[model samples]
Target: MEKTWWKESVVYQVYPRSFMDSNGDGIGDLKGILLKLDYLQELGVDVIWLSPVYKSPNDDNGYDISDYQSIMTEFGTMDDFNRLLSAVHERGMKIMMDLVVNHTSDEHPWFLASRSSVDDPKRDYYIWRPGKDGKEPNNWESVFKGSAWKYDEGTDEYYLHLFSQKQPDLNWENPQLREEIYSMMKWWLDKGVDGFRMDVINFLSKDQRYMDGNILDGKQHGDGSPYFLNGPRIHEFLQEVNQRVLSDYDVMTVGEMPGVSPDDAVLYTGEDRGELHMVFQFEHMDIGGGPEGKWNNEKWDLSDLKGILSKWQYRLEEVGWNSLYWNNHDQPRVVSRFGDDGEYRVESAKMLAACLHMLKGTPYIYQGEELGMTNIAFESIEEYRDIETMNSYEELVNTYGWPKEKMMAAIHARSRDNARTPMQWNDGRNAGFTTGTPWIGVNANYPEINAEKAYNDHQSIFHFYKKLIQLRKQHDIIVYGRFDLLCPDDEQIFAYTRTLGEEKVLVLCNFKGQEATLTIPTELHSLKATLLIGNYEQEESDTVSSEPLRPYECRVYLLK
Candidate 1:
């Protein structure tokens, strides 16, 4: 496989609104990020991926961009952004901005012009179609719930918005719009921004047929994802992006692609594809969801998680690269989702980190994940702040007549707001995130899980993550090594090996809360090994043994 800096580096994602609050504005700003530069540097991350900070109405929490060039007032001014960029570069770390070109805020100038009238020149800048028999243009449902097409009386036509009405999908078929996006990307690159995390990039191209999707929940409209996700023109548009703007700069780019398969991922990230450095696939994230979608209360099988991750690991080993992550701004906390977040939070967090970091990809750590933050339990629906969560709640409760307790249970397990709670810095009021009223309530368990406590504790999850990052920099095998999974059928343990030349490293992770025996293969049992790093501080024998691993224990050994 080809080598790249991004492949060898670890990325840290920060949701600016939840990261920190400065000036007591009840919101996190760019200057607050500047104040935490030393914190990130100490964590040893190579790249920082900042969520959307562009000018927005905050309808979808900055995903609905009103201006590509201006910074959101809630996030401070353009000067603050410039200083933050310079500070990150001076600290020897790269900063990546969120690129939400798949859609723009309805308040955006382009959308304002496109919605003026049917005959307007900018009308073609967005997807607009006449209603079909007094209904929507097609039987498509928005991701946030409801018809995908919204009727505009001014133009007497319908516009497509896959997410929310406030976020109108852009017309990628329009050459002028594509040029505008590329030009904006170049402007940021020229301003010293390192790269971009393109949001829902696969949804940029549509089928154009506007066919009705299969009805699933007996709702009038159906999920329109199949027609838009990874559409026919996705490759062409991405190649255009690569050739026009990305080719000129040596910056990393990772596309947020949902519903992408391993076969398609090869084309997207192939060494010569000229598309993206890597793509974030959601197969593993969707393992726990059922036919009803992510909010469904279903148990996730450990083997299923192993199968999904291993498939991508093996498929992309040679053809392309992978982007390994468990949590992000859009997903719930990892410890709560995958591991035992109650009694074994610290150990399971370290084990989960070791499992993904040992894979052949760039590891991404979401904000507060290094401290083993778990999902929050809001007492009532009013405490929820995510548009997606609120919409789903209303639909499930009022439309379907589902019990309020059941819907709230789903929200507790899957709401994006679970990840949007303020960063717990200390055990002070509002978790020391802000002196004033926080936009969202801080997690009530902040006293036990704050960063100040973790930093002071030598054996905390934060220090384990620091060691993992240090290991990646110290050993080249961790970056370019070939990966091989061992005991693939084991439901309780995850074991893998990374080999580069004569050097090899063995990684073992126990996913359960009971003692699990790791039987070494007979052929490899005699080899001598040295303990490289582990969550527990112990010197085991020099060779493999039939000893049982403790609950959520993670150990890495250097094979000789």
Candidate 2:
């Protein structure tokens, strides 16, 4: 397998708004990130994948970009961003900015111009259509809630918005618009930004037929995913961007692609494809969602998760690359979702980290995940800040007449705000995040799970992640080894092996709280096994025993 800097490197994602607050503004800024550069460097991450810090109206929490070139005033000035970039590079680390080009804020200059009048020169910059049958342009639903089309009084034409009405979808079919985007990207690359994490990249190219999507049962609006996701012209647009801008830079690029299969991933990130280095697929992220979507509380099966992960590993082993992650800015805490977040939060967090870091892909660690931060259950709806969560509450309780408690329960389990809470730095007020009031309430358990506490503990999840990253840097087998699943049917034990020539490593993870015995494959019983790393204390070090794994026990064995 071919090797690259990005493939061998571990990325740490920093949601600036919640990471660290500077100037007592109750919001995380570039200076806040600068204050924690040493923290990130000590964590042994090679790249810092920053979420959108561009100028925005915060309609979608910075996903709705109003200006591509300017830094968000809340985040700080361009000079502050420059200083942060230099500091990161000086520490021998790369910083990747989030590229949210699938759509722009309604307040964006281009969108404003496009919506001003039907005859505006930039009118074609956005997707707009006349009302159909005295209603919306289509039956499509906004991802947050309500109709996807927002009617404009000035032009009397409805504009498409896949997300919130404030975030209008861009028309990728326009060559002029594409050029403007490419130029903006080049400008950033020229400014010494290492790379980009493209947001919802697959949603850029939509089916021009403007066809109606199939409506699910009891749903008012149709699912427009089929008409927009991974559209026909996606490859053309990606290749054009690559040829025009990306090809000239030696930077990492990972596209956030939802509704993408392994086959589509292969086409997007093939070695010779000249499109992207890798893509973040949402198949694993959607494990627990039910037919009613993310709001429902559905228990995910371990075997099903193993099947999905194994499929991606096997399929991408030869062609495209994979970006491994358990949770991000958009998902709930992994320890709470998939592991024991109560009695064994630390153990489960370490296990989850080991499981993901051992995979043959670039692993992304979301902010505060290293400290084993769990989800929060705010007592009142007024305490919540996410637009999606608020919309869901209104739609389910007010419109559908679902119990408020049921909706709140779903929010506790699945809300993106769970991940957006302020990072816990210490046990002090505001979790040492800010002196002033935080924009979103800090997790109440911050006193126990703060970074200061984790950094001081040797057996903490934070140190375990540092070791995992160091091992990735030390061993090539972990980066390029061919993966093979062991005991595929076992629901309790998640086990796999990575083999590179004569070197081999086996990883075992116990998903449940009970002890489970692992059946060692008889063919490799003779090989000497050295305990590389494990969450629990070790007694026997040089043998691969068929001993039952402890609750949330994860161990990596180096066999020779």
Candidate 3:
């Protein structure tokens, strides 16, 4: 495998709207981030993956971009961004901006011009089609809810929007539009920004057939993913992107591709392919989701998760690279979803961190994750601010006749707002995220699971992550080692090993609340082992024992 700065570095994702409030306006801003640079530096993260701070209408929490060049008013001005970027670089850390070019806000100047008339030159910049038989252009439904096509009275046509109606999909087929995107990318790179985390990048190229998707049981809209996801011309568009803009700068790129398989990933991230450095695949994230989609209370099996993760690790080992993450701004907290968030919140959080960080890829830590922040079960649906969550609740309860309590349970389990809650800095009011009201309600458990409590205590999850970050920096084997799965059928124990030349490191985690025995393999019983890190403290002699791991306990060992 080849080596690179991103491949060996750890990334920390910061959702600006919920990170910290600087002006007491109930919203987080860039100056709030500037104040926390020391905290990030102390956490030992190499890269800060800042979520979309571009100018927007907040329809999708900044995902719907109106201006690629200017900063969001809620996040501060251009000078604030420049200072934050320079301060990050001064601290020997890099920052990756969220690139949301797959779609633009309907209020964007380009979209405003595009919707003006049929013969408008900017009309080609967006995907527009005439209504079919007095209905929508196609039977596709938006990911949030309702028809994907929004009829515009001005143009006498409907426009495609994969997400909200306020977010119109861009036309990647137009050469002029592609040039405009490239020019915007150069504008940012010229400002000393590091790289980009492209949002839904694979959705850029559509099938162009505009065919109706298959509607599943009890669904109102068709599933149009097959027509738009990883389309035929995706590689061509990506190659053009790389050649025209990315190749000119030395920066890392990771595409947020939803339905990509391991084979498709190799094509996108392969060194010889000239597309991207890596991709955020959604196979593991889709585990608990059922045929009815993410609006259910289905339980995910452990063996299935192990299978999916191992497959990616093995498939991307030789050709492409992987971007390892358990949760992000769009997903719920990992401790609540995969591990015990009740009695073992701290233990499971550390275990989850170790499981991902020890893998053969770049690890990304979402903000508040280092403090073992769990999900919030808000009392009312009105308490949630996420557009996806709100739409899903209305559709499932009022439209589909789902029990209100059941849908709320699902919301508690899978809502993206679970991760968007304000960052808990201290046990004070509003979790110290703001002096005034927060945009969303803070998790009530912040009193026990805040950063201040974790930072002061030596045995907290925050320190455990700091040690994991430092270990990855010190050991070359952790970065380039080949992964080997052990005990694949185990229900409670998730174990694996990393081998590089003469060095071998073993990782073990108990995924459940009960104690599970982890037997040592006979092949390496005689080797001397030293404990690298473990959530629970035990004597050094116990490192080689077949003792039962207590309730989400995790341990890593370096064997000689």
Q: Give all TM-scores, in the order shown.
A: 0.99, 0.99, 0.99
Least well predicted 10-residue stretch by lDDT in candidate 1: 537-546
**Clashes in predicted model 3:** 0
Steric overlap count per candidate = 0, 0, 0
Off by over 4 Å in 1: none
Cα deviation of 508, candidate 3, in Å: 0.9
Candidate 3 ranges with C-alpha deviation above 4 Å: none
Alpha-carbon lDDT of model 1: 0.91
Model 2 ranges off by over 4 Å: none
lDDT of 3 by residue, 1-560 (tens): 77899899999999999999999999999999999999999999999999999999999999999999999998999999999999999999999999998899999999999999889999999999999999998899898998999999987999999999999999999999999999999999989888999999999999999899999888888999999999989999999999999999989899999999999999999999999999999999998788657776578788899999999999999998999999899999999999889888889999999999999999999999999899999999999999999998888889989899999999999999999999999999999999999999999988998999999999999999999999999999999999999999999999999999987899998999999997779876677888899999778772465778989999898987
Model 3's TM-score against the true structure: 0.99
Candidate 1 lDDT over 36-147, as tens digits, reads 9999999999999999999999999999999999999999999999999999999999999999999999999999999988778888889999999998899898989888
